[model samples]
Target: MVSQSPPQSHQIYPDSDGKPMADNTEQFRWIVTIQQNLDWLFAEDPNVFVAGDLLWYPVEGHREICTAPDTLVVLGRPKGKRGSYKQWEEAGIAPQVVFEILSPSNTLTEMNKKQVFYDRYNVEEYYLYDPDKNDLSGWLRVDRNFDVIDPIDQWVSPRLGIRFSLNETLQIYRPDGRLFLSYIEIAQQVEQERQRAEQERQRAEQESLRAEQERQRAEQERQRADRLAEQLRRMGINPEE
Candidate 1:
């Protein structure tokens, strides 16, 4: 009789859920801004994990209970690539911070479900922003449950050290007083900086050239004076007098 192996179990959840990352340009812009800015903010820290639109399975062995936040930050987890965040594999550390950017397709029912899921999974800070309405909302974990933050405007994130401003449009500022920028804005700023640096370099070169020319002119004048003085000496006259 041939030896038979035991049946394998379905323990792996898929990396993607066949859903698009964003519904429209506005939603996609918010997602990219938050993800990129947070990535830059905590880049030097080895223990902070940041991801955008990645599937997060809060419970192990049950792939059905999973939700992908627009952007999520895990404080205790190591920074690396992950197909999906399996809570069991991450030392049972849930993501400390989560952000959701509202799209037109997002319904009230869906958002309520997300809130419950984040609450049940022990998320410390939850933020929701709607670009169309210029609305921002926040929930902080109070005791064992997540409670709504009253007057969400001008509220600072405890974990992120970033402040939210609602004037004109939704603006998020870093601790160092720099506002979060979209991909296009960041690219433009980089180009501007490059241009400024080039101008400075050109100015420095011009200054250097002018100094060299001045030195040459002074040397010629000194040579001319020396020749004149030598001629005077040949004529037995004091050039200095």
Candidate 2:
């Protein structure tokens, strides 16, 4: 009898789905702003995982069941590099928060499919922003189903503790009341902070130098007075008088 070979397992999903992460500058900016701000907010947390444009595989043995979210946050996962987020390999913890930035190329049908996928995959919070129209929408999980949040403006995210305000444009505020900044804005703020720190350092050094000078002046005056008293005593005069 011929020996039978074991059946081959299905191949893993590709990291790249042959689609660009963003279609234009505005879309890319939104993606980066959301992803980077979230990263900054959770930088100190060891278990918060933030990823942008990373393919997420939610099912095992089905390579086609995957979607790449614009920005995703997983609360229980460790921070690290991943080619793709395979749910089975991640201890079955789905991303708790997902952000989608709408581009001009996105169609209603495409967005509907994405919404269904996220809802079925157990995402706790879902946010969508349209930069061109200045529209913001959100959904929060209730009774194991995602429900639309009416009047998304001034909505606060439960998991992140960040607030979303939509006026002329979408604005996100951190827990500490700082606005979510773009890449350029963040860099400028860093530079300003560096300058302020440098100025503080210089001021401290100057204060230390002034204190040393005052101490030296006092020491010199005391030495001169002592010398005069010694000379008077040497000349047979009552120095005390």
Candidate 3:
């Protein structure tokens, strides 16, 4: 009998694309802000998956056809740690939303390719923001093609329920109308809340102290009146009268 050879393993899909997550600090900041905020928004839901700068492979054996999105949101997937998002392994559910932050190093051609890739992969929503220029662009999938979102300013994402505003700068608001904040801004807010809480604690303590003092004074007055009444009674005077 001839020995049978074992089947070869499939292609390996690397987690990283060997590229930095962001070319500059601005790009990095936007990426983190969008990803973290989305994470916070869907924190109560177990079916939303949010990742930043993670490679995504849309095909099973074709690992070469992959790209790492700045921010990728998969609504139907469970929240967990993944080295890379393999569409085949994810119940064949493509990432529904994606965000890209433009840096000085990004070229128009490079961005165009990303758009094409996302469109072909069935991305429901695509948002591109250029921090330096304060320009924002969005694309929403219509049928099988992505349509350019005109008057993109103040455009609310159907899937994400987040509003994008481009006035002095790009501001993204959550469904609850909370503005997306950077890590620094979030830290500052936390510090302010902590200080406020401390002040409130101090005020409560002071109020308690004041109440105790008032109670003590009232008790002392009552005791003094009782002593005077007893002396009057001992001297043959009716204290009540």
Candidate 4:
């Protein structure tokens, strides 16, 4: 009989990397804005996956080789909840686009390391933004290397198809020319829409009430005219005359 080998143990990939998602409120806002907007943009597509601060393991059995981007967009992946992104389970497809929002605590070396990691892992587009300084940078993978994008201001991302405007502050616009709104802004807009709809409902109700009142008045007038005609006939007078 041939000797049987023992089954290998499965490796564990932890979801959390023991680091906070953002260092400050501004950083958090930007991260959420980018992630939520991307999620909204691809909401109709079942195959697009958007995640924020989710650990991604590019290699199996080597959980140490992982990096979590502030925001990541994967084109071919399905949208769902995942503890972490395991490349092997995802058909070896890597995230196509990634965004990094800078915080005060972020050092140059740390950002550079993130760039290298992204480049090595086949990231097609990489963008970084400093909200305080209104600075933006981007890179596109060309010829198997990360190429610096020139004139990043007002530059449209090929994958996302969104325009970037860097004036006194950073603003991102969708393909439909709508600004990418933050969570608070979206909430405020929803409230405004709700109020407008409520007003419209109230106006419709008032118009309907007025129409009913007018109909009632016309009916009463008809009844009075018929009564007068009957009295004229009873008095032996020609009602028609």
Residue pairs clashing in model 4 are none
> Per-candidate TM vs. native?
0.93, 0.92, 0.95, 0.94
RMSD of each: 3.2, 3.3, 3.2, 3.6
Report residue 213 deviation for candidate 2 (angstroms).
1.5
Among residues 3 or more apart in sequence or in different chains, the pairs in candidate 2 whose N, CA or C atoms overlap within 3 Å are: none
Superposed model 2: Cα runs more than 4 Å off: 1-8
Where is the poorest 10-residue window by lDDT in model 2?
A: 4-13
- Superposition error at 47 for model 1 (Å): 1.8
Candidate 4 lDDT over 29-109, as tens digits, reads 999999999999999999999999999999877878998999999999999999999988999999999999999999999
Q: Per-residue lDDT tens digits of candidate 3, residues 68-165?
A: 88999999999999999999889999999999999999999999999999999999999999999999989999989999999998899999999988
Each model's lDDT: 0.94, 0.94, 0.92, 0.94
Candidate 2, TM-score vs. the true structure? 0.92
Q: Give candidate 3 misplaced runs (Cα > 4 Å).
A: 1-9
Give the worst 10-residue stretch by lDDT in candidate 4.
4-13
Clash count (model 3, backbone only): 0
Q: Which candidate number has the best TM-score?
A: 3
Candidates sorted on TM-score, descending: 3, 4, 1, 2
